[model samples]
Target: MIKKSELNRMADVANDRGVTVWVEFEGRRYGVTPPAATPPLDDTEESDLDRELEAFKAKNGYR
Candidate 1:
């Protein structure tokens, strides 16, 4: 059993990373998400991600 303090700390960390974290404890489900939704990245950011994905794929021979 996790202490409430510890659980809340974990949720805080997850929320900082723009994620919704979930856990199951004693047959119950727990989840946390940022209070405010994160905005979508602009075109430049999307293009940067696309380039990174392409590089990763090439490096891993996925292409």
Candidate 2:
């Protein structure tokens, strides 16, 4: 886990710039963004997209 102080500093910069902060750990990268910088998705639209993705995955034989 990242240190709290470092994470706080990164969050401050990201919030100020309206962008996301990326960190790498254990060979993987993660992003943290302020909620205000992200747009909310409509539930209906999200469900429709999920259904479409499931259908595509099934058609492609992805388990």
Candidate 3:
């Protein structure tokens, strides 16, 4: 079995490069890839969502 520290290092490398990382164990090869970067929400859309959230929070009496 691979050590926890080694697995963490592999994950770090994959995230830094935004590429797939693979490892072999027993007779099988396993791989992991970082998720694609999501585009930022438009300013107007974000503001509208924020307003909606605030309204919901107020209605629910959440601070």
Q: Which candidate's TM-score is highest?
A: 3
Model 2 C-alpha lDDT per residue in residues 1-63, reported as the tens digit of each score: 889898898889888887899999999997778667457899999999999999999999997
lDDT of 1: 0.85
Candidate 2 residue-pair clash tally: 0
Residue-level lDDT tens digits of model 1 in 13-43:
8878978788888999888777787698899
lDDT of each: 0.85, 0.88, 0.91
Give the runs in model 3 whose Cα sits over 4 Å from its true position.
Answer: 47-63
lDDT of 3 at 26: 100
Please provide TM-scores, in order, for all candidate models, with all chains considered together.
Answer: 0.45, 0.51, 0.64
> When superposed on Cα atoms, how far off is each prediction in RMSD?
11.4, 10.6, 3.8
Better of 1 and 3 by TM-score: 3
Candidates 1 and 2 compared by lDDT, better number: 2
Candidate 2 residue runs with Cα over 4 Å from true position = 37-63
Model 2 TM-score relative to the real fold: 0.51
Q: How many residue pairs clash in each candidate?
A: 0, 0, 0
Ranking by lDDT: 3, 2, 1
Candidate 2 yields a Cα-based lDDT of 0.88
Which portions of model 1 show Cα errors greater than 4 Å? 37-63
Cα deviation at 53, candidate 3, in Å, is 7.6
